[model samples]
Target: MITDMTQGNPTKTIIKFAFPFLVGNLFQQLYNIVDSVVVGRFIGTDALAAVGSSFMIMNFFSFVIIGLCMGSSAVYSFFFGKKDYVSLRKSVFISFFSIGIFTIVLSILIILNTNNMLLLIKTPQSILEGSQDYLEIIFGGLIFVFLFNACSALIRSVGDSKTPLYFLILSAAINIVLDLVFVVEFNMNVEGVAIATVIAQAVSSILCFIYAFIKIPLIRLHREDMVFDREISTMVAKYSILTSLQQSIMTFGMVCVQGIVNTFGPDTIAAFTAAGKIDSIAYLPVQDFGNAFSTYIAQNKGAKNNERIHEGVKSAARTIIVFCLVLSTLIFINSENLMRIFVKANESNVINLGVEYLTIISVFYMLIGFLFMFYGYFRGIGALNISLVLTVISLGTRVLMAYVLSSIPTLGQRGIWWSVPLGWALADSVGLIIYKRLK
Candidate 1:
């Protein structure tokens, strides 16, 4: 199950490793996408709007955990490539304890202030109670989120991407079934979807943990492995905190934009939500490919295979460009139909708004594609700060442009749509320049 990236053609190896990641992430996105569809169709527009808006907040916290796990996974890949089992074991121990504690503290704070947090985001009064209830239930599953991400990261670090995919497929199926049961059959509404998500997350986390302990010897910890080494801890903190900050900042920017979207009322919110999910699913292949590329680069870097790393950069670029172009064309052509899947066909206003957003954003998928490649490359090379800087540039531009352009009488919400690609173009430019200099 463990494939070595240090051997084989750069393109083939990276693609093979990345395919499972792409599939797994799709299933993962289904957790949110299914929630939105179920609520929007069965419940009502306001319910859909509440779930959609709440997603911005939930995504922020979820990315924090993802970033931490991703950062630590880079460390694991490096150690594994170096064949330093001792250091790998130590890192596994350090990251698990450190991120675990952080998740607990964060969950407590967020749960305690759920209502206040919703108010701060300027959630509309009509959807405020629903958002609060949804978030509160979702937050209760943070530990499960932490556990699942941590275990999967450790497993994938050693090049076993397929194992994680298996678990995610199972969990996603469970989530879909539960969503129907709770929301449609039992009529639990927004709260029903929230509970289903948490339960699904718990199932995946528990199964992933058991698999890691039984199957991945490198992840198994002895009592002696639990002892903290200051050196390893510092390295772990550097990768985890910086990556977490980068991810949190990026999502925080979305949270700000969500506040702006909230001002436009429930229709816009519902449309934006559906469009955003489709956008995420559309571009996810490239994103997951970037992550897989990172692991490939990390392992090569660890093995001192600089030549392979360089080759990988080129291979990844070509793959991303082709994939993004094809995906963009598909989404642009099918925007309206995709929207109808989430919103009712009779809800022409919501579908049309979502279609407009998609058409505007789809053509620029390559820009974000290139940006993700740069992010993965930087993270792989331990240039965590560079990744963080690129994120700030992209998301900062997004938040700023979104506010300024949207305020224009002529531009309005279209400005928000236009701002996304502008941010992507800016970040891609900077990333390409930096990579050139580094080369």
Candidate 2:
């Protein structure tokens, strides 16, 4: 499964490797969007808002799992490039094992605080009970999220992005079918959506676990190969923890913004939720590419090719610009129709609010593209400090703007929407500075 990335045409190789990830990420997003769509249409807007308000919290831990797995994947990419299978497997096992332990405890703590946390986010009184039902189920299934990410990271680190995509498709299908059956047929609302997600994720995690252990020769560990290296663990931990903190910090800022949006009541929250899903899907292609670039850089870094890393970053930038231009244009023209994907006929205000948010965000889509590119570039090369600094700055800018702007009586809810681009602009500016100075 370990393909030689160091030998291929840089741009083609990067895109080829990243493409499955792009598709995989789309299916991944479907898991969330389908939930919103089903709940909004069948269960109503309040149910949709209940699920929406919890996105920041639900995703916070998911990001933690992803960041750590990403760090492990970096380690795997490095060692795989060096043909150091022993150390690669060891790091993989340790990371996989460690996150399993960590997520269980975290899940328990999160479940305990689910209600209070929703309260802190200012979830409306009407949506409170449904939010609790949804979040408790998600947090309890954190193990599925953690383990699947670990398995996928290890496999992809050795150049098998397609494998994960297969399982993602399987999971998406399962989640969609289950979403309909439980929510529509059984008259279950938020609980059905939550249960469907956990079940689908669990299946994917099991499949990934099976494939990695059976098909991937690199992961076929022996008793002797189980040597836990402290140095390797420490190094993996260094990258993983730092990246996790970076993601968590960014999510923390979004949670603050979610709190601001919540104050405007359920309709606005429902609107934000719907629009945010579209916004997330739009950014996903670049994220997958950024991740692809990271693996590309890690392997090439292991090969000692600094030039390829630079070339890859440039390649990623071109891809981002071209894609964003097209995507933003499409979204601008079809903003209303897109918003309708999650809102019903009666939810006209929700539709209008979503259109407003989507319009503002599209204008700065290119800026967001640049922001992701640098973040991906820095992360690929293990420029953890730089990545952390950019994310923190972006987070602070977003949080401050959310509070300061949204507090203005005139701006109110629109202020929450505008805060997004301001944060992105500031972050993009700083990231550009770093890229220019360093280059």
Candidate 3:
């Protein structure tokens, strides 16, 4: 199922890869979305808020793993494009073991300090215990999250996006079923959904690891390949650490914003949670397409197909603009209805707030779309520092503006909403200028 993007029409090949990746990303998002829905509908607003708040923290850690894996996969794709099988296998061994140890250490630290982390985020007392319980259970699955993302990244590096999608579909289905069984039948509350998510993640991670070893000969590590080379290790560290920092910093800013949102109490917290899920789902296609474009560019870069990479940038930009326009219209029109999905119709205040957040941000999807493309492009070309700089600009603006604008009495929470697109716009403008200069 491995594809060579260096040889195809850039637009067609990128879309072909992105379609499955987009679906897989959707299923991946479902792991969290279903948890919120089940907890919200079955438990209560407090429980929903608890899960939502804890999610921002959890997302911070999970994205660290994702960024590391994604960064390493660029190296994998480069080697694959060059037919450097020996070095590729060695990298697999190095990245797997190195990141695996890091995940273990991180899991223990996060688990032990769960309460303090929540407190630092200004988690209100009313939902503190629920958030702690949810987070503790979720932290136990960090290794699984690392494993699944690592395997998926490696698989996708060689253009086998469909394989990972299959596993995600299976796992997402299991997560939905388990969410119902545990929350509705057992009435386990927030803890129930958290446990369901962990179990589902375990399924996906274990299955993916097994599939990669048995089916992808390129990825299978032999005894000799297990020995690390200093050069490869250095390369992996440079790419992985920079990318991980970028991803974590981006989420960390959200955690900071979540702290601000926490100040508004549980209603705003719940509304933000629901609205955030809708926003992610709405823009996920363009985001995943950006990821696909990264893989395409990485392969072409390895093969020294500079002209094709330029064509891909143009092709991806056009596709993203059209897609964003359609998505913006759909989300803007159905904002209220989407809010109602995660919250009850009776919760008028929560629904209205969520609608407000969506209406303001949904119209600006193209800005984030371009930003994602730039992140992908820079990372693909081994410009990890550029990606990090762009993320800092984008997220730093968001966090600082969210605090400053939200503090003004007139702007209030609406200020927080508007700050997002403003950050995206600034980042996109900078990214476009940098890319042009690179060209």
Candidate 4:
């Protein structure tokens, strides 16, 4: 069992709690990276690009639920720290119901307009059919993704990161094997890969829910406890909707960025995808730490331990800065080699483009670390409005920059790519300023 309260040494406590989560997040990204590698190797570069191209679109839907998950975790952590079991259960139930409704509705909407959606994004004509097939299967199983994320978030709220890691590692391993069987052995194409990915998600969802159902007593709610509680529901909805709006805007902006990348051709698309995988690895630890700190800070805040909350901030900032320095160095040094490892030189032009993006972004990776840390920190403290404002600034700037830069003759696609780091630097600076006053 992972420990929740940091009795002393907040940094050590957060690091310990976050290690399993870091591993879990890495394993999750592994599914994406490995799936792309297998498809690029066995099927073709076009197939790889098709799958990668659809990621932000998929995330657009998923992030709505993710917002609720993040919001619920903060609420649950608050209640759990106060030992208010009734409210905790209510929060959980309302979160599930809300997310369930949203997932079903959005999945249906995406499935119904699949062709139009793909065309709207200007998906390549050659790969459009494949992308549609992938989206259909993934949307069909969106509930699995929602439930898994909700359950995992709830569990982590109480400081049990290990269970989620267990499920992720198991499912990720299974996903890789299934990918080989479906795509390579049976020649399933993009649809096969997509199906395998969802099936694996289903398995993780079922296993994690079952574990929570049996072990987490809070989950076994009575009709009274599970009944819609207006106050809790309102709180969850308020924060979640705000968070969702911020994320939706961010996702919409990325979709625009994707459209820009698409215009650059498959080489740029494939390169962006491969570089993104490496970037995910670099940021994983800070993300996990931020996650852990969010719950830690929320719990401490609810308990009215102002000192503990401040301690957590210091610990998180220190850890994130160090993490940024280390990962940035590694990514900067071996970026070219990292891109090459994902795909063969003869098959994909991803290597050169990936190297360029990685090199440019590495300079601002530390800024991202600061941004995510403070974002989580504010969220944990129920300062959601502040977090949303930072997101608006960051995302708004990025989109405007991406739009203007994408038009420039000299910058072209690279200009869109540069927007990410620039946005991070600007956003983190603003976030840090606000956090300073709050601290």
How well does candidate 1 match the true structure in TM-score terms?
Answer: 0.99
Residues 1-439, model 3: lDDT tens digits: 9999898788999999999999999998987799889888899899999998899999999999888999899999989888798998999999999999999999999999999999999999999999999999999999999999999999999999999999999999999999999989988979888898899999999999999999998788899999879999998999899999999999999999999999999999999999999999999999899889889988989899899999999999999999999999999999999999999889999999999999999999999999999998998898989999899999999999999999999999999998999899898888989999999
- Reference-based lDDT, each prediction: 0.93, 0.87, 0.93, 0.83
Count of backbone clashes, every candidate in sequence: 0, 0, 0, 0
Candidate 4 per-residue lDDT over residues 1-439, each given as its tens digit: 6355636688887888889999998999898888888888888888888987887788777777777777778888888888788898888888888788988998898899988877887788888888889989989999998889888988988888899999999889989999999988999999988898999999999999888767988656778877787888888887677767766767777776787788888888888878887887888788778888888888888788999888788778787777788888888999988987777877545788899889988877788788888878888888888888888788778878988898899998788778898888888888988988888
lDDT of 1 by residue, 1-439 (tens): 8878999999999999999998999999997899999999999999999998899999999899989999999999999999998889999999999899999999999999988888898899999999999999999999999999999999999999999999999999999999999999998979999999999999999999999988777668888888789998998999999999999999999999999888888999999999999999999998898899999999999999999999999999999889988999999899988999999988999998999999999999999889889989999999999999999999999999999999999988899999999999999999989998998
Better of 1 and 4 by TM-score: 1
Regions of model 2 farther than 4 Å from truth? none
Candidate 1, residue 129: Cα displacement in angstroms equals: 0.4
Clashes of 2: 0
In candidate 1, stretches whose alpha carbon ends up further than 4 angstroms from where it belongs are none
Better of 2 and 3 by TM-score: 3
For candidate 4, the lDDT comes to: 0.83
Judge candidate 4 at residue 262 and give its lDDT: 86
**In the order shown, what is each candidate's alpha-carbon RMSD?**
0.7, 1.2, 0.7, 1.4
